[model samples]
Target: MLLADVVATSAALAATRSRKSKIAALAELLTRAGPGELPAVVAFLTGQPTQGRIGAGWRTLAELGAAPAGAPELTVAQVDAALGEVASASGSGSAQRRTVALRGLFARATQDEQRFLFRLLTGELRQGALEGVMVDAIATAAAVPGEVVRRAFMLSGRLPVTASAAVTGGERALGEFRLALGRPIRPMLASPAESLEEAIAEHASAIVEYKMDGARIQVHREGDEVHVYTRTLREITGSVGELVELVRALPCRSVVLDGETLALSDDGRPRPFQETMSRFGSTRDEQVRALLLRPYFFDCLHLDGEDLLDAPLRERNNALRTVAGAHLIPGESEPGAPAEILESALEAGHEGVMVKSLDSPYAAGRRGRAWLKVKPVHTLDLVVLAAEWGHGRRTGYLSNLHLGARDPDGGPPIMVGKTFKGLTDELLAWQTKTFPELETRRDDWTVYLRPELVVEIELDGAQVSTRYPGGVALRFARVVRYRPDKQAHDADTIDAVRATLKG
Candidate 1:
């Protein structure tokens, strides 16, 4: 298939708001892809290249003065091969090699194809080809059930491979995927709940576990071999030696355990999140020993060669306890009063509790209501420094807000973070109208505003970050409402944001 066809499909997807329309367009595109080209085509449509993160940033791509080709002659396979060369260019003069490869690829692409390739390489493609939509499109194109494709993707952990399997052998090929050791599957995610009582009400008999403020890990052990993976399914077995050893010591011959790992203080309180993350970046023995990560396994997906992915939470937790005896996370099953569990989790210096239905099977990669996370909502009145232009459905409106915290010395509001989450259409309309009125200057993407509007923001907490002037950034921040009654000076200070970082 030509790259122009894929670019046109992406444009069509971005130009519409209907899910049905997007699926239909993607399905049609998929049906036209050859079996060998299906992987690259599916991956590119999902705003990623088959060779992930080819070290080509916007700066490098901008310097390439390659003029666009008058006509579209670049094939999907050709582009994929060029990107593979760029990704493999690593040694001394790798930067120049990558530039040469990228230039060669871009010279053959038309204007639209160049734009699509730029966005795809830079991770800025915002067309709504979400994984779920792509899965539906693959099923539609291959004449298979969506559930079958989704299950294959969950087990395989790669949409490209799943797409190829579906297009080639249909359901029979997809069914060959299973929970294999050393290969990481996508971790199950939980939806946020309004409150603990509300979550308990949603699940009559549920297991309430402490939601630890730590990194998510999935460990696989077979005999003496153990592999650890991050939530994104990236292998980190070598970097996390302690975790690998811990899992290897388990009595089970082979198992897949899902849980969190974090550094704890001497008093047994969880350390700040940055401290836990720092362990992943360093391999020095002293540094590793200084901040040892302790695993708290909560779910056992496979135990003793038996796959429990389709089992209920009750059976999985039982398997978790048998294998992860001392390492099991603290929780109460069928608690008489779940509010106490929330209070206990908070008191333990952790995030709130995760309420899970006992009868619900482990739905990997899906954020359904089977598990709900109930945490205390932290709200701050922050000043809006700027607003960026929206994309796709949010086009023609001011979207992503630049949040700033008050500087007590009155120098200026310190930029803490930016967020486009939790914005309703009404809020977007209000912002589009109100922001320009307060605009001090305008740029291509963002409009700088006079620090007059104070917006109430809800967040999980704040974490140490070097990216912002405040030395701290909000985590999971979303708009609660506009605090028009409050002044910019009344907004939360940098100290207040820093204090939210747990010890």
Candidate 2:
């Protein structure tokens, strides 16, 4: 299909706030696409190249110039056929050229097609639709069930393969694959829980473990070789050579361990989260190597040749304990009361507790009831001082927020912190439409708003900082919810925050 055709659908999806409308547009594109073009379709729709995450990226617009003269006319099917040809092409030059050639060919198509191609390649269709939604669309277009496609994705760890199979033999044939390792599948995540009591009441006796302040990392090992990737699956193996070497020396031939990497003191207590995060986003191998790290394995997803994702948490934990050996994070029976657990965690200077369901299996990528985090609640009523325009999916929405607390002894309320976390799309849209009226002036992306809206901000804890106008600000602050019940004058005082810091 023409690139313009794809762009039109994307534009339609982008224009609409309705989820069903976006799905319908995506479904139409899947129907128009040929089998061979499935990779490009997937790539375009997902806003990524057909090449996986590790593949070379399209760096510049010039790299995607006009198609060559006298080249055979490319069709949608021809695009699909090129997948293997491009995959097999050797050397960096060939790869670069092929990427350019493919892009140029698509560029030769209509403006609408270019829009679709851009959106697809960039993967931010931004209509509240995600991978799961698109998978269903592909299945629908191919006369198959969504589960069939999802199963293929679960096994192959590649959406292009799943799409090709769905477009060819339908979902039934796609379901015939099994899970494997070395290939990184989606990591399991947890849905946000309201409270500890709510989680325990729902779970009925959950296995609560300490939620340490750290980065989530998954280590894939075989014999004396190890590959470590983050929760986002970014290859960070070169960063922590010591940890890699430690995993390589483990007795197991093949193992996939889920864990956290933290900077801990000699007493086994974790340091401030920023101390660990400071080492991240750095490119220097030596700098990353200098980072103090301790890998605390929590769950065993794979051992030897078997996939342990199917096993219950208790069983997986037992296997993880045996296989992880010295690297395992010690988890004990949860204390009866939340206060006790909180005190213990605080006394150790760690984060809070992570409650995991014993009977639950590893549900990769989906934040189900398998795991839930319970941190100590620190609530502060703060005023919304400024707001910034959101990006990507939240384009045209006011998403970035700056909050402040009262300073009765001062000239102005002290700027506590800014947050873009814990906000729903509804909230983003509401702020986008509402914040402009309350704006003082506009910058490139932010609206400087009067501090009239008081919000109750909750945080992990307070840490000393120079970022905020206040000497101290909320650390890891997120919105508990709008404090409509409280007025701006009634916001929490800096003295109260200072008291917490003293504690």
Candidate 3:
């Protein structure tokens, strides 16, 4: 298919608020796509390159000065190939090579295609549809159960690859996607609870365990081969050798363990999250020695030749304890012990505790309420929609931020609230320097941004509002930190903000 066809479809998809329409548009495109073009097509429609993170930042994209072609002639494969060069370009003259490649690619695209390409390369499609909507579209195009496609996508950690298999071989193809040893699947996520008691009430029989403030890790081991992946499925086995060695000594020949890893202080208390990340994100040997990370296994998704993902929490916990032994995170609260567990977790300097239904199965990639995380203070990952120049001592800086929560439907993020609080001088300077690069358009009062950056914000709660498009606004929202580790796609949805109001 021509790249313009997909771009046109994306424009149509973005124009609608109905998810059904978005899915239909995508499904129609998939039905027409050649087998080889499926991956590129899916990637383009989702606003991500098949090559992934081709180092084309806003600065790099802005440098690709090309006039749009009056007519479209570029093919999807041609664009994919060009992006591949951008991804592969490195070392001497790489920047120049990438510039040439981007210019050439954009020069052949029509005006709409150029606009679409700019959004796609910058990782903000704003097409009102992404992986969630695409899942159903893939299922419709392939004539398979949505759960089957969802399972395959979760296991492979890539929807494009999953869609390819589904399109080519249907159910039989999706069946091939299993929890393979040494392959990491996306980690199961938790919903926020209003309080520990509320979580306990919802679950009835619950396993309350410490919710550690650490990076999530999924370990897969097959004999001598061991691999560890982060929440986003980036392999980190090389940097954290100590973790690999720990799993290597386990009795099982092969296993898939889901857990949290953090660097503990000398007193055995968990260190600050930044301290853990300093070692987690670094490759320096000295940093490793300074802050050794320890793994606290929570759930076992696979053991030997068996897949425990279908098993309930009770069964999975047993298997996890059997395999992980002392490495398992202790669940001090069972059934009626939610309050006690919360206290213990707090006393230990941990963030909070997680309440899980005993019989719930591991729903990987699904952020359902089967697992409820309760923290003393509420926090949400919100998208920065705009910024305002500061006055007084903060003048000459973009100090105040306009925050938006993700729209659950296939739509742009809806404004929830705004805040100027909790920014350091360094943060103000960074925002002043960076916001203009991400600018879509601006007014005299607010410099609007493309919703691409995720900011972790702490809030008192949320209240029904007439001022925001979301119909609610965050109360006393303050920036906790700028989460460079996350993207706008990972921000908390409006539903979550409303949940707080409901509570």
Candidate 4:
């Protein structure tokens, strides 16, 4: 299939506002693609690359002609040349030369085809569809259960591998497969629930655990060796060497754990989520060294040659505790007891609680009702210091709002954090219309909101920081609503913040 064809379909899908239309468009494309090409095609349609800085499309086309074994010598210049050729041609050439020749071949495409080609090559085909939707389409096209794709994704460590396996071996094969390392699995994530009681009622047999104010991380270990990856599956091994060392010291060897890694205070409390987020993709070894991180193991997907993902949550928690010892997140109990656990977790200074269905098997890349999160609604009076214009669908709105708490010693209201989440459409429209009037200055990207407006804000937690003027940062800070009744003088002070940090 031509790259332009895929890009055009992706663009059409992106333009459709209805999700079903987007899925239908993607399904049609999936039915037409070669089995081996489906993964790259799905990745392209979602505006994501399978691997490396280059498009998987280039690699997919090259493989069509059967490239030689061994890591083929590839360079930046070669990738550039191949991408350009693929843009214009029918993507046909000797396997060895296809990628390198794509650059020249791409130039032969028609104007509309060229536009699609550019989108494909740049991996910017931002259709509403994501990996989950593609998984469903692939399952439908391949005549396999969606769970087959999910299991294959978990065991094989890559969705494309799972897709290829499903295409070749059928659904039964995927259900029997096991996990291996250096491989990626579709990560499991949680969706917010209406309430903890509601979540418990929905998941009758769930394991309730503390939800820390931290960054999600997956750790891969082989004997004494360990590697850390972010939720995005980007390997950040070098940045968290201390945690890696800690993982290596665990009683069990050859373990792969799914958990959260966050900067911790001297007393072992998690730092604000933002501080932990900043550690991601960081280049400074000194900064990495200075930050004290604790790896809180919540679940064990794989350990000691057995795939624990299919085991009940209680079973998985047992295995986790045996292998991880103190690293295992405390409170592995039934959903019926979550309220008690929630109280304990809160008293321990955790953000709230994460409830997981006990009988739920790991669903890679799927946000099913298997896992849910509940948080305390903590509100504080804060000042708005700055705001940034939103992008994509939110382009015209002042979306990213910088927030600050009062400094009792008296200086500027120091920036604690910024957020675009938790804003309703009505609030977004109101901000769009009103923030301009409050702007102290305007730049192309941001408008500085006058600190005169005191707004009640809510957050997950506070942590020590080097970025903010107050030497603190907020976790998941969002505007609750304008505190019109409160003045700037009534805003919570840094002393109150310091007390929260100390507590």
**How do the predictions measure up, each by TM-score?**
0.78, 0.66, 0.93, 0.65
After superposition, the stretches of candidate 3 with alpha carbons farther than 4 Å from their true spots are 283-289, 386-398, 425-450
lDDT of 4 by residue, 412-445 (tens): 4767878888787877897889876555467889
By TM-score, is 1 or 3 better? 3
lDDT (CA) for every model shown?
A: 0.85, 0.67, 0.86, 0.67
Clashing pairs in 1: none
Number of the top-ranking candidate, with lDDT as the measure? 3
Model 3 lDDT at residue 251: 94
For residue 120, model 4's alpha carbon misses the true position, in angstroms, by 3.8
Tens-place lDDT per residue, model 3, 45-99, is: 8778898889777767777889999988999988998889999999999988888
- The TM-score that candidate 2 achieves is 0.66
lDDT of 2 by residue, 1-503 (tens): 74445556656655765656666777778777777666676655554456543232334323466544332234544544444455466775886766755565565555445444433333223333346656777777778877667667765667777877888787567866665555666667664455677766667556766677677888888777788877656667877777888888887889988888888767777865546655555555665447678888988988888878778888998888888887876556454765566568767876577778888877653446668766666566788878888789988888878887765421235787889888887678778887765565578977876556777677876778887767886778887566443345456667656655634
* lDDT tens per residue, model 1, 185-286: 977878667678888889767999999878888999999999988876777787778898888888889999999999999999998665776676646668
Say what the RMSD of model 1 is. Answer: 11.7
Candidates 3 and 4 compared by TM-score, better number: 3
Give the runs in model 4 whose Cα sits over 4 Å from its true position.
15-24, 35-39, 49-52, 55-81, 84-106, 121-123, 172-177, 285-287, 332-337, 378-503
